[model samples]
Target: MCGKRIDHAEWRLTKSIVDIERLRAVAAKHNVKIPDDEEDYYRHLLNGLDATAQQVADLPEYEDPRLQIEPETLPRQWFKQKPNPLNGWSHRAEIKLPSPKDKRLDNRTVAFKDNVSIGGVPLTGGTTPEILTGKSEYPVPKIDAVVVKRVLEAAGTVSGSANCEHLSMSPLSFTSFTGPIHNPWARGYTTGGSSSGCAALVGINQVKEWRKRHGLPPIDEELGEGVDMAIGGDQGGSIRLPSAYAGIYGMKPTHGLVPYSGILSLFPMIDHTGPMTTNLEDLATLLGVVAGYDGIDPRCTPETPLREKVPDYSAQLASFKQTKQAAGEWTTSAAGKGLRIGVITESLAVPNLSPEIFKVIQEAISQFESIGASVSHISIPEHLLGPSIWTIATRAGIASLGMRNMPPPLLCYPCPDITPPALSQSSFDILDRHNPASANMVFNATLLQERPDGASLAAKAMMHVHELRAAYDRALTEVDVLITPVITRMHSQHPSLDAKVEDKMKPAIGSTLNTCQFNVTGHPALSMPAGWGKAEDGDAKMPVAMQIIGKRFDEESVIKAAAAWEVGGLGLDKWDGR
Candidate 1:
């Protein structure tokens, strides 16, 4: 076939599969009877099949220095007994590196979400039992993730790994194998995940109290002091949700702005990793350090190329302030001057929205208006259908792909060799056994087998994702950015430690009703604390947040808008005044 001679090995493989049970079953379904003597038929197919396999296997590997580069990392012994105030750190270290030259992030202290590989540190993604015990069965990655390396190269000190949802598959912090991540604001309340610990650590929530409770030295608190920033991975609101609950700034930059080369991925298309910070400046600086192509992730496109030098994201802030300065309106009251902000009607009107949360967002909008921004209501009806589209695509399509040794949306890190703690036949089953940490994700893969027409249903759902993305793009044309509630309601209490898996999952689903849409659309979305609202019992107050979504790859606008909101002091009253 095609002038290539069929060799003995190819012929043997074909002969072995000639009477494979699957072939017979497929033939029966198609009503095409194969002769019992099928040697000739099998021989005819071997040449072409073998050639195709060889061609794929021989495809050249992607070449890049970042892929080959291995930076110096802290020894594993350093991570075992480091401080873990707030239960945020999965591994703690004081690893510091020098940049080749002057850089914007010089001297910054940053912690990474557990899924971002940090060489010798255990990457549990907050699920693996060995990681929880501070002992790992898997070999530590020799090279750090591209973003992690970039951060160190920019002269940033890596504090350690932050705990996250089990395998980063759930939105509730309690699902982490290490235990529930307590909200800094309210001890028993949730921190909103899967970037749960990143936000808590950045917020500096509970650290001093946690230390005091553990009989450690008190933090040297001073005015305007705390951790600088944190890097978080977002695949459907992981970064933004946790930041929203913690009352900090978090960004999910356009999908390909940062490489996904060294991180665990649910589906590559919806995957993103970005910055979470207490202030706008660190958020801008961190994004500058990590945002760009590294030539390894297939998700990066030419439109979002990795730059040879980092852009000054803070310039976007300077421009906004300069315009206000020119008009003699540079004060905090003039923060949002000349900006156009749209309140998304569909997002705010979500079912079961708390009235206190509604009031908090309304106050935030008024703060924007007072700062000279023109605010209006806008409707993108299709956004209400985001949850449905996410379910079909992630559960039906993405889960199924993982089952057959494939990950969808192209370009994902190969699943590693960690044994799953569970005992299911899911496509995502990586372990020899079963683990409950991945149960929510693994079980979804069985949708194909559970339903007779599951494959067709998933296919249709992916088509809807495209349509939904287009709808968001169209709405963005009408406004500079659209604002929505980060979550439909305020953060809830953590699930009981003894809660059943199904019970834990019950509060987890649908929490991303507003934030997940941008993951599908591949747009830049930022979450900033808006204000505080009383809890359900009216005894405790918690942070409320608003999300700002901009056009694809337009991270500057999202950052600038959030900066203005922060400067206006709409949400600062709730801050502990650090």
Candidate 2:
């Protein structure tokens, strides 16, 4: 019987193995080491399959007499809930327009992370079961998230919300609420999350299918014969990781450059909304619409408006094309007229990096040098605070928020029979109105005692962030732009569902260490695909992305630099090999 399924299973398994080995070979060439115990690893993989198979096999058989059951009775009032509005107007309207005549984006379908609310669609950040309820009880949001609204206005249709990590917290895309998002590029390896859905849908051509069903043109036709862009959000590499795994372009705009007023935030301080695309112009145009101040969000500053204040970006794009056409000297004069680039050595040395990432980074830097951009390595001694402080602060905030809103009993671990002991007393105590104050006191006390030393660590982390920012500023005294690998590793294998929590935490270090410091310091960082890496599976390719970090409010320079890289053909150009 197992042999009968072997052809189908082997076909699936072969594809997965090919992609996995491709990644392994890349890692090996770059000096990355994989665990040697192949049998043990396969055993672990099979165990997960066993659990899933058992669940499917154990499902009740309808004709079995012993399992026959009747529907349960319900209380009379259970069916009388008030009706919810199904098609109310959205709080904010999005603007959808075609690419401008002078400088057009290669029309590509773009998908948003669900965390960014669209007025009419369910707006779950992969958490809040209310958003996922098919009944559509939640009212249409009055306003769309700034990023969603902007993408639409910039000529991209609002296809649909992509699945995400619940509440945008987990690095692994797998969750109990929504099944794991598979990597279409490499079947067995996981697509990194919480932007997992956005990556998978676009990578697998699902976004194109959605667009076609909705009366939109295919991305290739939209992009004047080739699909060339995708857009998403980033809070700690949400955009970058998906781009890497999916083989595309992604950016995490400087903190606050893109207004995030209507988006669900994982951490208010670090959360940002940005774009991910297959090419640079799509990024530039999308940024134009979304980058502006909103009275609603105090974090938005009115000082910069690349869309309204600077030379027409479309026009500048034309100039770039003309320059290329004429074979005129490509000088930093147009974009970097005056700037400096710095590479952080500490980031490269981060532990446990897959060796392929190191090679990719080295190759990317070599590319930067060949492009006439001067490069030098530097250290932000204070950057050591990036990962530790961010974890403490973000987790404490989430824990506190949960305690405040959720009923006390809901916070405890599940129990099949009696209520769990930790929450049993609290649940009963809250039954009386008069004990509300006591409940508040208990929750507040617990929060204070348990809150991670974020304030202290952040303060220390901030000093490093500022020091690094100043260093970049000083470096800009001579050079034009800074470049570094967006992250040190490609997408890791899908984590085992049964693995211990410690194992889950290990893969995130590369993204957190290299990307989070910018959030702390408030600089604009762009992660553009730079090259391809081997996937653990042989048939698919893993992408390597590079970061272009620029001075505060200088997104135009960042966009321009990325565009040059794209035009120069330094990164993967298509979803499938051309």
lDDT of each: 0.72, 0.53
Highest TM-score among the candidates is held by which one?
1
Query: What is the per-residue lDDT of model 1 for residues 89-120, given as tens digits with 9 covering 90 to 100?
Result: 77776776634344667777888898877766
Error of 1 at 371 (Å): 0.7
State in Å the error of residue 463, model 1: 2.9
Which TM-score value belongs to model 2? 0.65
State the weakest 10-residue window (summed lDDT) of model 2.
73-82
Steric clashes per prediction = 9, 35
Per-residue accuracy of model 2 over 320-422 as CA lDDT, tens digit each: 6566546653542222212245676766777666677777777766655555555678765555556655554444443444222322222211111111122
lDDT of 2 at 556: 66
